[model samples]
Target: MRSSAVWRALPRGDLLLTSWPWRSLAYLITGVLLGEVVLLTFLATLFTGAILATVLVGIPLLLALALGGIPVAALERRRLMIIDPEPVENPHRRPERPGAREWLLLRVREQATWRELAYLVLLVVLLWPVELLAVVFGLGAPMSMILTPVLRAQTGDVRVLKFWLVTSDAEAFAALAVGAVWLALALYPLTLLAAAHGTLARAFLAPRESETGQRLAEITRSRTRLVEAFEAERRRIERDLHDGAQQRLVALTMTLGMAKLTEGAETAELVGRAHEQAKLALAEIRDLIRGIHPQILTDRGLPAAVADLADRSPIPAEVSVALPRRLPEAVEYVAYFVVSEALANVAKHSGATRAAVTGRLDGDLLVMEISDDGVGGADPSTGTGLAGLADRVSVVNGKLMISSPVGRFTLLRVEIPCAPTDHSK
Candidate 1:
């Protein structure tokens, strides 16, 4: 049912009855018109730019000539829909930042822009002329022969397609009958040629697979940056609470304790109560700050961070992380969280008495494993939060593997690619 069905419909008997032939004609005709306009514009611009090159006034004109393919390719893609119903995706990437300068710079650097320029040059110099010839010989000659009888009737003689002389009524009628058959057969090749042209246009105009991969990589890098920024903001908030609010609470608790020593029994009891509340609030804020971002991790890096996580776990846990140097901040951050989440899962679900966290560097990779002697059947699908951990690891292009068979042990392993940042302090 689609216009692109022309290829399949060609061998069918009912092709002439379908809209494909008319659509093919439209495609070729428009191509010729567009080609003429492009040719004229290119010539005029090239001549003017060359003449004014010495005055430096021709630079913008030359730039416009180079970028002219963008609009032409866009229009050609739209016109391609006459015989191709499937839409062609625009291959150009958006500028990293908004503005004409950024857009122009990006476009000039992209391979797609140059490819489009090549297509425009081919369209004007080559493809359009072939399309024009197809229309003329495939449709024009047959129609002229078919109209022979009408021409002979008005003038008493006619030249059929300038090839055959129709001097009698019988001759003119014979040409008309033959022309009808010729036109019917000509439509088949006409539709085929149009489809071929559409295929060529798509090949030139659509984004290549490598370009798509590059765009995907760009997106991943952008996501990584956002994640790093978010982690930085978390650290900032934690620092502010620890340095600003927590210190104020500590000073207030000290003052309350001093007041309790000097006051009468009733006043001293009230001061003691106030001092206890201040201490409790201070403890809660410390826990909150740790949860937001561990200051220990910032100071001592990943090994210390993992050790701290093991220390804070409810179950008995041991840590052994040996690295030659510090890792990148983002990799360290993701690794720390992965270990934290894994230990939490172990504590909450694993019926284990003891757990161990071990880490080592395998070349450029940071490999960490947390294992426990527990009844273990961990399924990410069971809402155990392992899926979230997997997502977090993937943000840094890391892998997470789990081995938790029933009644054996649970082992959570994560490997992240990273180069050493600095020698371990």
Candidate 2:
């Protein structure tokens, strides 16, 4: 009878404890530690912000570093998906050359910055209070212990302020029971647990309106980078022309002029050298144009595009191409680039007997896979190759996955949403 009465009068936690008797210990530990975990998470964000600020300097470096957060913020969102047990959506992608200065400047200048900032701000707001409380809860009790002696003496009597409700010696003893609800602010442990859960949900679980904006921003940024890459490549080609073909042409023209001043075997040799230089210059020009846009791709679409690729490989390429008619230009362009880059990686890195490129249109997606049976250990983090592929996929609102374990085949897969027909039209 006493045990039952004791249980009944116990704080609500006793009922909860009995229900999860097996997990009660674990729950207590987690509950007590919750606030500390929240505190650490908030500190991590502040640390990241500080790190970015400290590392960034000047206009270019600062802009570049700030834009770098787009990817990290996107990663943070993905982490939330797994931890929050909610759907993980796409992450933010910003231009390699995103505009703006401070967050306020960038928020007005670039939507992606605003989106990324909103996510960070919301996450911090959600975390800071929880973290602060958790820190307070975890530490406050001990701090309170230090003050208890002083508080006791100041009162002159051990008077319980409203704790007088425990009129009976038994009730007062019960209320002050060690490790029980009647003990010092015993309600706090439960409050701390709920706060921790809410903090985790806010920081890592819940997807927000900003996630959608981030996805759009990533696409926009990737597109801008790709265009910038194209321009940069063009500039490189122009530089090569000025240095190689242009110089060669000038030398060839000068040699022909010199040949006119002589008429012997040496003059004949001079004309031959000029002719050879002209051929070399022509070859360089072809290579430069190919870099701009493989003319075959523009003329005959992807099959011929990849065929030109396969035909040139030192190691033979087995190519398989399929499509459901044609796709929207946006999807097709990304699909082509993904295949091109994947093949380039295979040719450069993969020690394969043979390679294959496959393309097919599935539902509203243009799915393409390029594979090579090679000495493999392909990781996304290993190089800029897969990162570039990811950016390409991002630009087209697509996904890219790479699988390569040691001694297995390396496969690069790309999927981009495509429409066979436009509804708005």
Candidate 3:
């Protein structure tokens, strides 16, 4: 908020008393200096590169001349922060590799490079002169007039700058009064001019207009990476529980069974109880492994997995899936889980005795819908797990829609863009 533009902060008052006028003056002075430097350097580079073209030694120089705007624009962006407190964003993308060749290749192809070059040309030919004129007319002339009494006191009734002749104390004081008024009025226009220059600089030097799209793309890729890592970790946990803990529990159960057979009646009941406990723990571990990731989903694909879910649900359910081939692994995983969560919601809250699931591959999108007839008023916002399901779907750029009205049917639909991995019939 403190970094808002100078013009925006103008309404806060103390215009003449504040540091803004001084800051504007400084901005103009620097602009003139930078404009001269850019003009001379670019002219020399272009003319020299043109003169030595037949020898082929000037090719690199020509290329360097084209990229000269990059540094000029960078310096101007820094300079702009003097008048406009908001920092300008550099639009250039980083190179894929660490070499100069990679940097130039990327810069040359970018639209920001050309826009910056155009700004540099305007700076040299047009903008700096306008800035200089505004400063001279707006500040210089008024200050000169305000010094009329001082000038008249030093010289006897003399002409000031050969423009206004001040003959006496009254005339000199009158000229000073006019100058004071002019300076007061001039400061506002001067500040506005400086602010306008800053706006122009920012338009060219800042980030491209597509910044929102760029950020969304970055977030999407980041979420995809996180999803992949999460899936891998789930598999790792499942593998560890199956290979390590489940094996030990199995051996414990077998030992307890043998002891029950060989020991006397007194020890037999104790052995049997221990064996039962081991069996229960083993079953719980197996269920945890299934919950983490089902083997059927991996082996038989999404359709068979959904059918398995239907069979396991407490309520009777119907499922229809028509995929000629297997979808991408991530797509299938998200789709399967969405169905699983929706059905769980149906069983727990919908109070419906029956539910239906339908799925199909529609072009590049895999569409699935789960519906139930119940006293339905499901709100995803009320911690019904639909909110988390929506987030999971968005990880793969998918969409989830819920149509649940009070005292009616609840329908959950999801669509994700994906293609079948194996096309062989």
Clashes of each: 0, 5, 0
Q: Write the per-residue lDDT of candidate 1 for residues 250-281, one digit (tens) a residue.
A: 76777676775676786776676677767766
Please give the lDDT score at residue 177 for candidate 3. Answer: 85
- Which candidate leads in lDDT? 1
Model 3 residue pairs with clashes:
none
TM-score pick, better of 1 and 2: 1
- Predict model 2's lDDT versus the native: 0.60
Error of 2 at 397 (Å): 2.0
Query: lDDT tens digits, residues 202-288, model 2?
Result: 443233567666656866876777787778777898899999889989999999999999988989999999999999989988887
Deviating ranges (above 4 Å) for candidate 3 = 1-4, 9-14, 147-159, 165-177, 230-425
RMSD for all candidates, in order, please: 20.6, 21.0, 20.1
Q: How does model 1 fare in lDDT? A: 0.84
